[model samples]
Target: MSDSSRVAVYLDFDNMVISRYDNLHGNNSWRNDNARDHRPGSGDATDVRLAEAMLDVGAIIDYASSFGTVALNRAYADWSVPANAAYRTQLVDRAVDLVQLFATSGTKNGADIRLSIDAINDLVDHADLTHVVIVGGDSDYIALAQRCRRMGRFVVGIGVTGSTSRALVAACDEFSDYGDLPGVRAVVPTTKVAVKKAAAADAPVETAAAEAGPAKKTAPAKKAARKATAAATKAPTAAEAATALLLRAIRVGMEKSDDEWLHSSSVKSQMQRMDSTFKEKSLGFSSFKAFVESQGDLLELQSKDNGQLMLRLR
Candidate 1:
């Protein structure tokens, strides 16, 4: 919040941007109706319960102040393509300034060269700067980090794990893999691509929530659902199936043979045992507790210990 506490963010706008977009949002390919209806926030794939689980902004900001006060946050990239077109809005929305560069004719690409020069100039001018966060994996920034280190400034390298140069990290006082960024767990691999086949799906009738996506929603991120489903496979239906399976699974575990009640924790644990990946959200309910309450008639749900839901067969 304070300028002294601020750390400059250096982002590799092109490659990293593409990677995040593809991993979070599905690609425009294929003939899968499920892909269209089940993208992350859509009615079908509304599995992510919390807003935090859906979007991880904290990770992007990174922890610059961890080592020292970051005086400059610069992300380097060439914003000359349509692929990079949408990112402009997102950057501003996040309050991250995108430093635009062109793919030049020389040895050092324009982005790398421009960023390095700017970093050097800042080091010479900003005496209070304690650390410089190089956000790209490109080794071009390595020398700049080294320069900052020689000048007594901590050089913290941040980028995708393995993508960053080990040499660069060793040269700097601290290094953090972008994948290791605080809130971003892992990139979900996109499996169901509707862009290719949906454009070609025979009739392409509005099978599911066809009316919803035209404006406000994106189907569930199949990647998240796939991971969640893989984790929840044994407990209930396939990942693509409804939230009904999870509810029933919990009910089955919580209900006694005589139709007596069971603790909500017992049901939650049972569901988790069936699939460690089973989260109240990945199934599309507001909370694991909410999912239990929604099982009305088939089951009775209540709060016992600390406002947590308890369950029993109806």
Candidate 2:
């Protein structure tokens, strides 16, 4: 890829919102709750679970910047809806041009059509744009990806995991799950209380009481719930995550090269490609080498004859 490569990002905002809601809540939960009509910061938009599942727009844009300069970033949505309106501040902060689309019918917001048209037009009009990023998982975008590739432009897709279409993944030059993107924290599953309540609701009254048992039985259940909550809330530390990323990067770099040793710069670049938001400074290291040295047990490092730093998995 050329150093001067330009990228255009087209986001299907509605798709992201609905997909994220369904992923965190139950399937079709967004529609079932009539989330579209809820006032901004009200209803599902402010729900703790939905907030946990919120898409990190800044992270997505940051990852896209890794490829090259993001010259054009546009998001298609019915901004009038509260669900979409909730994201206005973040989108505006990232300088994403919001294209408002009125709902044509109950089910269709015309995002796929509008996004496809704009992406194709941008690709045709700007010869310098070398990368096209489509930020939705609908199979409808298969044709768009095909056309962009045919025009010699690289196509990248980002979508929610279960909600994304497999065909869309095959069509793009690269596909990243939204959850896997850098700076995106994993969504914790539903709470134990919620799960228990749901299960109790389905079971007969006798079974529910039997499962509840006496005070002793209930005491153990409460203790277990507390432990589960603690475990769910305890996220991995920055140093640990960074070390794992470095190890994986080294493994991939070594696999790609015939030599056992991998250059420090190459390994760092691979890490960024895997996670653009990665920075050794964030982990309190002065330099990448310093960070690598901190993981002395997992990595073997040495200076080449020419003073070039190299590393290998220990």
Candidate 3:
């Protein structure tokens, strides 16, 4: 089935890739490190590395969006250098259009301008375009989000946290902190802790000695694999599945309705309010939405409205 939502994604290669390295790794060079922050001659290499990194980012999103039924995917960059050759290859592989531009003798590079112009033009031209996703770090695009909203289009900005312009974050309908995106956070080997316990609990005492001895090395590995295999096969239970679906619906409602902070009482009241018959105990849940909230991922308890629980982000 085709998704009803239509979104156009724009990648600003020069601005965002630089953001990954600069914000996370910092300018690797002495010049960038010691130079006055963002000052000329400052060893800041974000500008140098940004273009290459953003190209990869564009390619990834180009692929992800397709699965989500995104209607448009475009990457912006100046393509004179051989360094950007890898970028071009991935862009093509991911079916992204490479919007190329140039720098003139008196003027600066116009990649950002090109990106902005094309985004706005398409927003007006394509009535089906409900959401515009931007891949970039420079705060310059902040105004674009506000402007697009005025024209009645939802704008979603993507960038590493702390690198995106505060203006951009505040202006957009929703900002996907690229840093927190799935598979982006520093992997803490969450399985490691879980594995040791599983091995200790499941292995027979005699086998435990054998396994924890010379064979012990492989025990963690086997336990980890088993855990993963089990997780892959186990579908959410009826109660859990319903909770997960409702949580997503709530998030979608907040996004579409321009309500960033949904009231806790309203959220609790609405689940039951939707159907007076919608009860927690009947669904094998303990306390209505509370039971639902306990089982999901990517959602968190934000606060309370009086005494009720409020959820913010997952």
Candidate 4:
């Protein structure tokens, strides 16, 4: 909590969106298939789902919290553009100061320059700030990061994995891949289910059966209700398999940890370490918390005073 431990975060909004686009499409079929839909030089908003997936501001903030108290948060972008509108409220809700940079003729690096300038200014003016978190993969900020480090401030970098520059990542004291963040989850859309209405004729049969006695009730109805109850209480077989894999991953981390209670974030990191292909989305859960909670029969969850979820096996 001390001023010397304060951390400041800087975000390059356009760079982030472009990086995410590359990660999702990247010269693949998605680009060719959607080329007609997305016209060149349109300056239009990208797909909402892709945008949301790329820059998960909340998840990034939560990840940064593990480092230290975030004292200053700023994001640079041209707010007038319709493409950036969807992300504005998200930034505002998180108290990120939005620095607007309008597009001008023959210039494209204004936002990047502004972000670097603001970061350097914060380093000079804020004596308490000891950490700087740059949330972009652009090589332009490499010099800025070096300057902050030379001033004795620890620098942390965050960027999309494949699209990030290796030099920029190496410039920081620590680097985090945005895709690997705990709360960054891709939700697979669910298929619609068919609904059946109850028939009027069934009402008389139920009434007569009840009037006759409990013995007259159809066995199929009772069996169906019991099956539904059981299904609700217990996870499906495939889900259990996924739960077992999760536990194994966590157990590997538990061996290295000193405490019985581990932060949910740490558990996720361990999961990735154990298996790169493991993703909660593959098991039908949107977040790690949901996946952990699904195995309630085998685990117990408690909220710490700091608001971090602690996991323990039952």
Evaluated with TM-score, which candidate comes out highest?
2
Best by lDDT: 2
True-structure lDDT of candidate 2:
0.76
lDDT of 1 by residue, 1-314 (tens): 23354355566665454333333444422112222123332323333221112323334542553433334556666555434443454455445666777666631247767777887787778777666777667677778888878888656676654356777778777676555554345644333343334334523556543654553323334445455534422343644333443554443442223545666765565444333466767667786677666667567666666765556655
Give one digit per residue, the lDDT tens place, for model 4 in 97-176. Answer: 88888776532648778888899898889988888999999888899999999999989899986778899998999887
Per-model CA lDDT versus the true structure: 0.52, 0.76, 0.57, 0.66
Candidate 2 lDDT, tens digit per residue, 1-314? 35587889999988988898778777887787676666532222224444555677866776676677788999999888866776766787578899989999986988998899998888888999999999999989999999999999999999997889999999999998887776566666544455466456545665657677741323334444455434434556877768867876665555446898999997897677656679999889999989988988988899989988998888
Candidate 4 C-alpha error for residue 80, in Å: 1.3
Give the Å shift of residue 120 in candidate 3.
Answer: 1.2
Per-residue error at 3 for model 1, in Å? Answer: 9.9
lDDT of 3 by residue, 1-100 (tens): 1256577888876555455545544454323533112322111132223221332342236223422346788877656543344355456545668777
How many residue pairs clash in all the candidates, one count each?
24, 0, 9, 0
**Residue pairs with backbone overlap in model 3:** 17-54, 18-50, 31-42, 31-43, 32-43, 32-44, 211-216, 298-314, 299-314
The segments of candidate 3 whose C-alpha lies over 4 angstroms from its true place after superposition are 28-68, 105-108, 185-314
In candidate 1, which residue ranges exceed 4 Å CA deviation?
Answer: 1-6, 18-58, 65-70, 105-109, 192-314
TM-score against truth, every candidate: 0.48, 0.66, 0.49, 0.58
Clashing pairs in 4: none
Worst ten-residue run, lDDT, model 4? 189-198
Span of ten consecutive residues with least summed lDDT in model 2: 40-49
